[model samples]
Target: MGVLSFLRATYDLDTLDTRFTNTSSTPYKTVIEARGDAAASKERAAKWKSQGQPSRWNTPEFYLYYFVLLLVIPYMFWVAYDASRPTDPKYKLYERLLRPGWIPGRKIDASDSQYNTFRSNIPYMAALLVLHPLLRRLYNAVVYPVKATGQGSRPTPEEADQRLNQRATFDFGFALVYLVALHGISAFKILLILYTNYQVATALPRKYVPAASWVFNIGILFANELCRGYKFGEMAALIAGPTVQNSVLDSGSTLVSWGRWLDSYGGLMGRWEILFNITVLRLMSFNLDYYWSLDRRSYSPVEKQIDPAALSERDRVSIPAQAKDFSFRNYVAYAIYAPLYLTGPVITFNDFISQQRYKAASIEPARTLRYAARFALCLLAMEIILHYDYVQAISKARPEWGRYTAAQLSVLSFFNLHLIWLKLLLPWRLFRLWALADGVDPPENMVRCVSDNWSTLAFWRSWHRSFYRWSLRYIYVPLGGSSFRTPRDAARSILTYVLVFTFVALWHDIQLRLLVWGWLVVFFMLPEMAAGFLFPKAKWEGRPTAYRMLCCLGAVVNIFMMMVANLVGFAVGVDGLENIIAGIFRDFSGFCFIISASMALFVGVQVMFEIRESEARRGINLKC
Candidate 1:
């Protein structure tokens, strides 16, 4: 009776027994507290997003090589076309460009021999690349601003301070570092190709070439890894050194030295660590996988997680146990295989070794050609999209992002985040084509990311799926994934996914913003997972129009939120991000329009594509 009265009074519930006339409205204090909390939580969530990370990415102007990639496609096409033309005007354009020719009448003349040598010089190209983006940035800052809004207004001290990278000097410094590292990576790539072509030859005796390639690659990478260890010496000195002199030691050393080591270490490593750390990580994966394969043990279907009903021996990617024998050579060679090294469909050692001896029959000529054409188009799309307005928006300082309409900022946010499609798409396809020609079946990295129907979880999983496979095999299943029935089991599963996101974030760039991005990813994804658990597809999904429509709405909102969070998370620094967050909240109406319009376009296109795809499938089935 007491419980009924309390419930009725507190919640204003209509009960069958209307004995208790406790129909008093919510208390003034309670209503005020709730409203305060609702407002406070929004502010709290925004600031909490930046806690303990005084930094944003705070990284360099990397990806200068993306410019090289942009130029390479056109060059490759020219080369192909140039090779085909057997006529008198053969290679005229390249010849003119290579030679010193400018403005028709007053044409600059040069010795062809001297000009050719200087023109093809790697240093010259690297310098040009390093300068191009920097110049463009400077031009935006000084000579010409892209948007009228950016040019018209002068910012306050706070606004100026909010700009993430206002230092052209720092950009130049990092651009130099970027160019140097790029040169190393390019050298590594060239060496790898030369090494692979030599190693994969039929004439080269088994074990010799792989061993030589291993030694060759490992030796190169080990040198870089050794240089990375130089920091440990600095670390030791920082840890060992005392503060406040010998007089302080009489009373025991001051504890001011506590964070000195870390500060020193960080000051020393700053941002160059990205270049060094990546090489070390790739080497670790390669070395570890090769070490495991030394014994060549074979397991039964159950142990290998092979279902009896799933695939025949012919259908599955199976290798003979004998084939798995670890040659230190194969390990090193596969680890540093140029195409797979940098942008990977992050393949495993065992799979890589197996592919080394792939049967020619498995590679259908027609299929490879089709795949090439389709992927070529994808590459073109990637290049075309790089020229997008959103790309330019992020390029310049946006400390005053608030001045732009929230819709403009939202478009910037959405596409800036989504342009990763090109980064992954361009490289993965180019590498995959070469890998395919080598008889290696590279798994798809991205599958329908844009058209993934706005499911946050699906988009995350679909993007870089090969890496997801690696995570599953190495991280997820090992942690007892997908068996969450109890609270403890559920925590384990969620923690495993959190680690997966962390790994992905850290893998891309070792930054807290990325870790937060990962957190946001898993947070957004969890609701869908919980919903799937509670409501089975047959019972709750696709049964009625309204339920399905609700699902679609949920999907759109999730995707929009995902894009917003990602953009802010990936913004240059905390202040730039702060401006964006503040801007969105200041004009919530404009944000809503941005979210709705962006989603309507994204989801609407996806829906139409899916419908067309479904119809095509049906037609194919009918024909069959």
Candidate 2:
């Protein structure tokens, strides 16, 4: 009777206030008083008021800066063309520049040279410039809508900030470092070419003419800087004044005087001069521009508030069902030819989130056969175009044919870049279906449950997708599911950085030195990682202009870095660090400034095109 009475007292039905009704009068009164006090205190809290609306980060000033950087492309083309011109005194410049370095008695005039280097490279450059925008547009049109529609609500500011920080830390710090290191090792083979070039140049019949010698010297310097450490500022300083001569001997009087003249300039102009004159600068500038245009939008509160478990039972399918929808035909059509597949058009949970809601159609034999035949043809054509023997034959027959003549080199570089896209698109689609079918019990919100940074950080995630998903599900989430506390988050950040980048670095080859380099640079995202924990409220709202600008800057910087690295890798192989460093120190010039300006412009134009295309496809006007 006593127990029943207590139970009856605790279970309130009549009173609207459950707390008071469920408890004894004395305790209930005390609880009510405490609650009242807390509510009153909250009411009295002060609120901050801002003077005005927040200003947009994307301004004309930013655009102007970007525009100037892209000019490097045209400038490099101009320089190369000029160098190959009959009136350019090419051999005289070489003779003047490298008087005592190697061969001491030969002089050649640029005007008399038979090499059509500039003309030959036009096709390659045109391909890049045209293909980049076309591909971007195709991706935006085909893929963006599929991903954007039916996305979950965005996240709150705090949640978004946390995710962004974590992503930046892991992707930038860990993945970039590891991948670059691995790439560096593979790139090291370029060094053999440099060494051979150096030997051949020295053994030439006469000492190289001043202009020719200077070009060779610059190439060597580029190789050195990339393989080893050469500060941009220092290189810029040396380039301003041409006196920063290399060891390649010149065969002309004017070469020595010209070198002396170049030694005199000491300001930004001099640096610009050096950066602009080098072929590597063009490549670097282009890369930086491309990077700048990448998407950097953060999730909105609605989008972030996802729970995978909340999905209805019917919506949940086995891994087999998931994989079933992804036929070989769709795989190649969607994955291979898709322009975004080339270099990632930002992928979000939104892109694949709808798959869970639909039933896949039964396999169609005719469709499968058609796709298979098309895929085979495409592969066969590409293989023929990229054949090593074909490339070697072309190079031997026409050494001065520029990129086309060096078809082997061109194809290899293209293959490397393209292969990344293939890996991302094909594997990602397959793995996503596999994960779903396997009944892995995805979180209530499949989109939110998966690591957001996985798509953004690593090129592989953006390109080779199977491994990307595995890393995210198995590695990222397990370490610290979305909302992590400080210390744990930091540990996860560092470890992820080390693991991903290290894997990428080691993937190409297992070299200790390459590993060391990968480790050293991979931690670049540590600052962003630390910031995530420290400033939980600092979230990035999707400001298209700002995002584009930053991506452009980052891309350009990355490309420049890669170009220098590529040069060094070409000259020194895996252990070319010493040689790369020595070459830069031995030959400094004033071409970097021009390169920087040109790169900025190129990136700006590309980004503008992308924004325009995106807006046009969406039937919306860009807000300038």
- List all candidate RMSDs to the true structure: 27.1, 27.0
TM-score for each of the candidates: 0.53, 0.32
- Residue runs of model 1 more than 4 Å from their true location after superposition: 1-324, 360-362, 388-390, 393-396, 451-453, 569-575, 588-595, 598-624
Report how far off residue 476 is in candidate 1 (Å): 0.8
Per-residue lDDT of 333 in model 1: 54
lDDT of 2 by residue, 1-624 (tens): 475653443232211112112221122223334566866545423211122122322667646645554554444434433333335333232332211211233222211111122223335534543554354345435543233333446333334333323322222232223322323322222234323433433344333432344355445454544533233333443554556434222332454445444444333122222222222221221222122212213422235453332322222211111222223222222222221221222122221222223212111233223323333443344333222112212222222222221222322232333322222233232222222232111111111111111112332332233234434533455455343356776566677767765654443234565465456444434433343445443344456556545545554544434333332322223433333233333322213433544355345545444543433433322122
Model 1, 323-362: lDDT tens per residue? Answer: 3234434544554554454456666654554344322223
For candidate 1, list the clashing residue pairs, or say none.
none
Write down the RMSD of candidate 1 (Cα, Å). 27.1
